[model samples]
Target: MLKNRFNIAASLLAIILSVGFIGAPIGPNNGDPTGGRPTNGRPTDDGPNPKQTIALGDRREIFADRFLIREMKGARLVMHPPRDEGPVMHFDQPWESNAPAYITILKDGDTYRAYYRGGHQRANGKKEDNTCYAESRDGIHWEKPNLGLIEANGSKNNNIILEESPLTHNFTPFLDNNPSAPQNQRFKAIGGTNKTGLLPFASANGKDWKKMQEKAVINEGLLDSQNVAFWSESEQMYVCYFRTWTGGNDRGYRSVSRATSPDFLHWSKPVEMTFGDRPYEHIYTQQTSPYFRAPHIYVAIGSRFVPHRQIATLDQLNELKVDPGQHKGLSEPFLMTSRGGNVYDRTFMEAFIRPAMGLNHWSARTNYPSLNIVPVGDGEMSLYVNQDYAQPTGHLRRYSMRLDGFSSINAPYEGGAVKTKTLTFTGKALEINYSTSAIGEVRIALQDENGKDLPGFSLLDSEQLVGNEVARTVTWNGKTDLSAWAGKPVQLHIYLKDADLYSIRFK
Candidate 1:
């Protein structure tokens, strides 16, 4: 079986909007209270849910659309903090700050355990690196564990638990990954190193890690050194994901790579992974990192910054825009595939929706979207888009829908939106007709109560439609008897990119 991988490309943006709901109720309908509609005092609950508003608090924030590419012809470059809102933490120190490539969530009884790699960086001109630790009760706010574990260049007082040993700089950590496999009490971690050979350290408790006495877990002898690992049940084997570079570009060296591992021990050689223009076209990028299986799927997050954003305004002033051209990517999320060999290749690529409104750019004020997939129903899931669009202060805006209904990730239509209407009935086929200027595109998928996309039911079919007079007409010719879609509470995902619907008839 092929390895299933999900990558969220870096290019986080913050979006901000200044709007308030006078009378909005914050209650849990299903997933997040933020996924509800607002009450506009019309004797009906047909308004934006006030509870869904995300507050930017004291950081530089923006709307989620900044990096999400919600609009096709929108802005391409979105900064982390919209403006110098004073001390915005877009890119922090200790190199580990940006080293959030992979993360794992462990269920230690009633407590949810999280282990992540703090990337490498020089502190105030120091050569050492460090990894931090934090635990969460509700998986939201985290508290530091007062353990004596510490990594290299880290303070015993700070959240540092394990310092980089002689093996290499301490990296990401993973615990008892294979649940279906034996109940082995195994733990592992991988990262970069300055030593000649043997890197990566494994331990029983995160504190006392032992160096891999065997081959190097991951050592391509290149820069941007980062490695992530996890266990897979489908294949019944352990797997690792990592990145590395090859040569240099106009600005500097250019590297795009990925790799997989069977056991946390011996690692396969690195394989190159590239997207977009010439390798050197984009600058300052990190390999894709892996995340744990919460809702049940191998998730990875990778980041890269377009040098154009970092350039002095007077230099590349013509490249800036309010609506970014996100599709032409230098930075975006993608799906990775693990074939037989050591390298895990990229299957499909798409822009990850930022939890906030805008892109994480340097010039203008911006915010990067925080993203995570949530389970909606048996075969449905919802995308919780927490944005600060409505209020410059920041507010949560939600768009819920099924995961499999749309043909492609870039389907112009979203699952749950103001214009989205839910239709229920019992029949062999489902058809829809609308009245609008043009029906931009059609996305037919199922979703959950929270409007997240489900995994199993992702049967997608898309087509570019032509406009018919003032109203446009589109239909879903069920390839399979969709009678199953009826009576069982299924969602119909219809996107109105360029058209509106006056009436929707199902037959």
Candidate 2:
């Protein structure tokens, strides 16, 4: 009888091996090693299975992408618009009277520096664009300091920094934070047109500037708009995002291209950025840069241009005193995020900064945001936009948002839950930047890779988190420390009731 049983088992094993089911488990409980259902009370569906565990070592993950999300019910990622704080600085200077395009703001130490292209029709009947400078003790109020570096309008008493043609048309600069960067090249800038390629400039103090090289370092694209370059801390190299046409030289839709360089001089071949499955649209200027709070994520507040989609009629354009040749198109700001690659995640297709309640904002090339979003006040960050473009009323306006408030996972009053993908984190506590209604709250549960709630970290043990804070620690049964589960594969099940979870980090 024993020999007969052994023969039957051997035959079954052979059949299983032939069918390639040797160690494969089958059924609804396959996700769990113990042949039990997930503790989250939901059967595993044929959705995206958890791949390799993400090693998020105390990094703050924002809700700008669906990277770490597994499943969500009654909740979604929502983009938040910045609050318009009105015009902060006017382009009323003689050199900046016509229009001020390609604005870039950098907060260096205690002073905020503003750089932009200022141009006005010269007496010779030619439009001469110059790179101008301004400084502000507070981001709210700006003053043009007469740097007297470059002579403009027959005077060196202007705030003109560079008067070189083509280069000053869209001069964009950033403070180099790379440790290996030379002291003289502390502030690096890129500017030029397609005719001249893209030129590189450097400065020891941002006030004094010189060409890093006599010739253009990058020469492969249209390079008409603001060609922005900065030392990427996450990539440990210099990255540049510049303007390019999809069909080639000013033929197809205006898009963006990216290139990298080890030394800012030698650049790799440019690669056009792809917006997955998104319909082709004119991306006039992609103000792509690393977010200050989270350097790993590149935030782009680009201008979406619709040629001939004129919102302001001729009469309205005349009423707003828009320039004669600039009234054909309409442009508005849009939000896009990326994770250090050629792909941009357009999670929110809506306008980031909608046209305000005025015809001046509806004019052509209006509502173009500046390059960087800088922090202004406590838990507040500000983004500057060029409103009333190609008009005498053109100025840089400030818009504010809560820190890390670009997008959030919002849940209604009926309540909802979100589950994160399997991840291993380092840290003793989990902190979140969130806001909730008076009667609303948020709760969190730590679960194993199989979605089984870990002991002492279940939803029932989670204390209700209520109120608004930029960073609030989550606790379970009045305990905040989670060091015991550090470096272990786990998932986060978050329950929310009319709350907005902006960002979360384990630290």
Candidate 3:
């Protein structure tokens, strides 16, 4: 790696970047730091209001992608923590060491499956390090079935998914949801090194695999991170996000690059993922996956690596048996969201998952989030994290977030409001996933295209909503039915006082 001027600037940005403040304006007004005004049309005594009417089905809309927020006052995006579910899988085999770090979790139909690079033993004794697999009925408990698929050294009596390829370094795969995808290629993966670039792999049952081609699809950066790819239903194409360099020694500093392919084989030239007005930080694994409930919303809950920024004391490291070479840095899960493009909306720069209250968590390479966030139970979702990396205690742990709860439009007790862009929907009632303090309340109002309050749907008619709920139907004038305005263009004026609105949708 060579240090350049841009690398120097990025290094400074990374060093100065705080978990809470990521070059965003979270000051008194609590408004859009980029100054985004109402998108449709400003409310005036004489203008009509419809910007572009959208049909909102049972889709759960979130603040993560800014698809709904047109203008907000005294409300900002908030990050939610993933509740730890403890370590569910381990690398205990002689072939499988504690170095099985880069893990991927996915919910396949009803079966939850996980894949990871589980060996560093090519230099030790094994023929090659291999990609391993684990399965679960529910995501909480895991079992590594003896797949008998690939032979790592001599025996096929292991959970190894793939072996004898450079792809095992950091193999990342996705369950293909593309309707036109071939049955045998239901599971697709991308992994390799800059020496050979990123190669594509496909599997019929996610166990037996075949290389799509000998040539690498992308060869821009040092593909050391867990390079992830998936069939994008939202864009009707295949999108891949992988590692890159900004400016540094030869490879530069850690950054992200994106490319798209109409077909899985051909891809556009790689482009760097940009964050608007935000300083750059090293993103270790950009585990970009589509939200299960709302397919349009893509979330990147990846490991934010801050190099050489040590926080653990010498005694603490010694007590936990931390690696002295890796102790100078720390990492945490940070979130970045996208609709479908090269840009990531880094609205919140805070650690999505912090180090646990212990000495082991303060070391480097821990807290790296897994590839996918899958639905674990009814109305609940789970994501796996690799913790205590490179230690004897290293294993994959689970964490959870509410459905559509990655970020929210929150209001303080002083009160704030969110006005949606003009939208048209065909639903009977408006429902919200929200929570409020006892004294807090939320009210909803339907507005005409001109931004005037629609009759019988004004804020005054809206019943005061007070409670914590995953789903609460908004009522107005003792009526919860919104069928009268169904299939028409309207805007939502939501007033919140000491409340957090996680998501909204209609039935």
RMSD of each: 18.4, 10.8, 11.5
Per-model lDDT: 0.35, 0.84, 0.77
Of the candidates shown, which would achieve the greatest lDDT relative to the real structure? 2
lDDT per residue for candidate 3 within 424-501, as digits (tens), equals 776798888998999888888899866788988877677879998888999986898888888787889787778989
TM-score of each: 0.45, 0.89, 0.86
* Steric collisions counted per model: 99, 0, 10
Off by over 4 Å in 2: 1-49, 121-126, 247-251
lDDT of candidate 1 over 326-419, digit per residue (tens): 2122332222323222332222233343322234233221222223333333433332221211112321222332322211222122211121
lDDT (Cα, tens digit) per residue for candidate 2, span 78-181: 88999989899988888885568899999998889999988766668888888889999889999999787776677778888887788888999999999998
Report residue 51 deviation for candidate 3 (angstroms): 6.2
By the lDDT metric, which is better: model 1 or model 3?
3
lDDT of 3 at 125: 59
Better of 2 and 3 by lDDT: 2
